[model samples]
Target: MANAYVLVINSGSSSLKFAVIDSQSGDAVLSGLGECFGMSNPTMNWKYAGTKYDVSITGGGDHHKLAIKRLVEIINEYGLAEQVTAVGHRIVHGGEKFTKTIRINEEILAEIIKLSDLAPLHNPAGAKGIEAAIEAFPTLPQFAVFDTAFHQTMPSKAFTCTISNELYKEHGIRRYGFHGTSHYFVSREAAKVIDKPIEESSFISVHLGNGASVCAIKDGQSVDTSMGFTPLAGLMMGTRCGDIDPGIIEFLMKKGWTQEQIFSELNKNSGFLGVSGLTSDARGILEAMEEGHKGATLAFQVFTYRVAKYIASYMVTLDSLDAIIFTGGIGENALPIRREILKYLKIFGYKENEAANADARFGARGIITEDGTPVAMVIPTNEEFVIAQQSAALL
Candidate 1:
């Protein structure tokens, strides 16, 4: 048989990201992003063999379907479509029904759609992408790699909400942490760095990106995580408000704010953007802070402090802390954020290696801490690889 190639699709509310990976070698043969989807000017930007390509699509009604069609056309143009044996989709919320990766079918697609309410901003968009892929490649096998699957190992004490048990039983309201693939990948890599078996290793994997979260892994299993029930409950992210008081919602409602208004504020207008009254990107926030912007300074401090607090609190769950691995965009690239976080975590004997931390940026992976207990390290996450691996295994 020809070498199996898996195409991993991560569809968000406004964009679709894809990578075609060689399953055996775990390398991305091609990757791209379709941005401004569902808008007047839809654009597909891709990289192939270190070369860049950008094309604008005109009059594509549904960008999800159009993006997949264009992607398929590109694959066929390069004569690489024949090598693609399977497709893997990144589903944000799997609820309790799916605890592992599974083959996608009509029934499964329907279930994913049914779970849309749980992840209104993600599931609907993901379902649209899946449908489009299925239509475009009817013969190809596809699988769903869920973000919530990795945290299924969490105990009831860790996942259960403080609300009434009846409400949880009826509504399935509990902590279903996001960013499981990144946390799982980094934790395994961290074990290898320390020359310890993952089955016996304990780690706090911090995934700080536009959408951030922290995970505590004990013996390769998720014990507890920062995000609860939805991606909105985690560490402060680009636009989402993380860990806000419940009373605030009620207070806003009493002030004549509709549920839609409140939801929009929390999910799209809050977090670093809300606090700083500036752009949501961490880089922009940091730049503004350097310019003596008080709001930017406050936002940056809160973001780092919340992350540090979670890392410290997760220590209680680990009997033996092998290392704390930082992955994702902010975690791997932002040196000052890493330093500030470590400064607060001095109790764990973590001392940052200034030069090493400075060098670890833009996908560079290495230990950034001086040789000591609970070493600090940066490991750029490859979630697409994990999706491909899981999809190929299912096939």
Candidate 2:
């Protein structure tokens, strides 16, 4: 049997992150990024067959069309274009309309664009890329895998806001978690690691990265998650001020802050960067903390504290947590952060195996918990591969 290959594309407002993966084995055959679109120095690069290549776009990166054209050209040059069976796109927001991965059609594309109001920074670019891909490979099977789809299983208690019913009904206002793909993938892997059936598994999947979120998964479905309405609500992220009081926004506006200015502050200047008055990168914060920087220390404390608090709070949602699964940039690589967060979970009987916890980083995956204690494991999230697999499955 031939391996099924999927071209996975995650399109941002100004960038495209793409990979070709063998869904059967979950291995990316080729991967790279196309970024700085609409700029003078627009560029695209990829790593394929143990070789890396860089290409400067001939004209300005005015739009997704040019970058995608070059992408298809390269794929054809490599002869993998024909081998590719389908394409999977990562749509950041599907609103309440799309609850699962579905093959894309004209109606689907239209729906994707309509939901842009809910994900201004993501859905529009995703829709544009989908349009380009349709133009590029008109016959290929393409699918839309939404980040919010997996969380649609969340019960009303977990998804509802205390706002009026009219607002939710009329404006589509309510909690819609992001990173659903990550949470879903990690929870399934956590079940495997614990040697338990996914149907019986319960977990608090913590996807800690620049954009972080904690999700409570039970029986392989998302019961609740940290992110709400937008990606801005969640664990203290690199820049997002997660879970703030509504009054703060109005208060700031009355104090002479514009709506745009307040949003910029909350989404770009808060979190570790705002708290530490330093860079948003966790590595930088850790290094600064080691060097005795007070701001860094404070950032580390607040970051870890909030994460631990979230994990603890999520524990009540699950009848029995099979494990506290950690996966994402900061969750997988930042052992110090994981170790610190686990220390806070010690009260819940999560004992980290110092050696294993320290060893599990940079492509490593394993249980970081001590023997016979409540499990806390680190499993790297593979959202792209999940996208590839889900995209293939719909066929």
Candidate 3:
């Protein structure tokens, strides 16, 4: 078992979430997250093999660099650095360039940088993590597991935007869907739970998190999805104004607002947070709903309405759906939100099983759909496992 570990790094704009797992077994030996990058005394927290390892690191102008340094240090300090085989990085957007797990080389690294503008918040961080890992583990192999890889099965019609051909060729202006890794893993899990072979099942996956999107899986492949050219194009996200009129952006520009301001409003100042004038947190909104808060109610309605509409729209893509699966934060945990979504799904012939719906044990996986109706289930997503599995296969 020489060099049997594989390190998985998922980097965000200001945070790096990492895990070290046994490549042979896919069991995470340690996991950690570093937050508040570029700020002083950022939170560097971790859990190593069942023990909590939380600590703050003071002074960091470049937390990405610091995060990698700390991560290497922790690996060495815990006596778990031995037999480290390779690094598997979660790259957010691989564009149309990569459709599978790829070994990283200078050429691949350059290509990743080329696509950074489209995923400004994520790609750069991914590149930074890759660079730092290469510096530290120069002799080790590294693989990139792309978020957009699974959605590559989407036909041109589903991913192609109604934009100009010149823009498409010049700027890659097409619907490069995100969160594909999550949808991919959860859909397979759903297929298993429904006792159907993946290739024989058709499912609509609703991934509801801070960033939300729905995907339609037909014959175990992604046929269509809600997200467009970016993650901001689908259902109402925590802050992002998903599916807003493009005219609003043009209207703002006419008012003499800078491009930066308009982007900020659509990406940051909208969604449940914007509509409710309350916290973007679903938990907080649900709490307000209990207190008879109208704004919160409206926010919840908007969220569910978009989800239901897309779920129905996606049904057309699937021809006929065998099951509907829920994954991501809100999709897995929010009971009331789940109930509301099912209420609108009656048109799809989804008759919610009240007993199972209210059963807290059904939190992770449940048959929300009534007997003989299309299966509806909850499958906890495991994107890291998918990466690990893919990395192991490469070995």
Which candidate has the top score in TM-score?
Answer: 2
The models' CA-based lDDT, in order, is 0.92, 0.92, 0.86
Give Cα distance to truth, residue 282, candidate 3, Å: 0.6
Q: Write the per-residue lDDT of candidate 1 for residues 26-45, one digit (tens) a residue.
A: 78889999999877888999
Give the true-structure RMSD of model 2. 1.0
Badly placed stretches (over 4 Å) of model 1 are none
Per-residue lDDT tens digits of candidate 2, residues 1-395?
66779999999988989999999889999998988887777789999999999987786435688888988988898888777999999999999999999999999999999999999999999999999998999989999999999999999999998899899999899999999999989888888888999999999999999999999998889999999999999789998889888999999999999999999999999998999999899999999999999999999999899999999999889888889888999999998899899899888888889999988899899999889998888899999989999998888
Per-prediction TM-score to the true structure, in the order listed: 0.97, 0.98, 0.95
**Candidate 3 residues 1-395, lDDT tens each?**
36478889998888889998876666788888998877666888899867898888655367777778888899899887776678899999999999999999999999998999889888998999899889878988899999899899999999888989899999999988888889999888888887889999889999998999999999999888888888889899999999988998889899999999998988898998999999889899999999999999999999998899999888889667878888888888888888888889887678878777666233457777689776777887878878877876786
The CA lDDT at 177 in model 3 is 85
User: Which regions of candidate 3 fall more than 4 Å away from where they truly are?
Assistant: 1-3, 23-26, 59-61, 360-363
Colliding pairs, model 1: 175-229, 176-229
Please say which candidate is ahead in TM-score: 2 or 3: 2
Global lDDT of model 1: 0.92
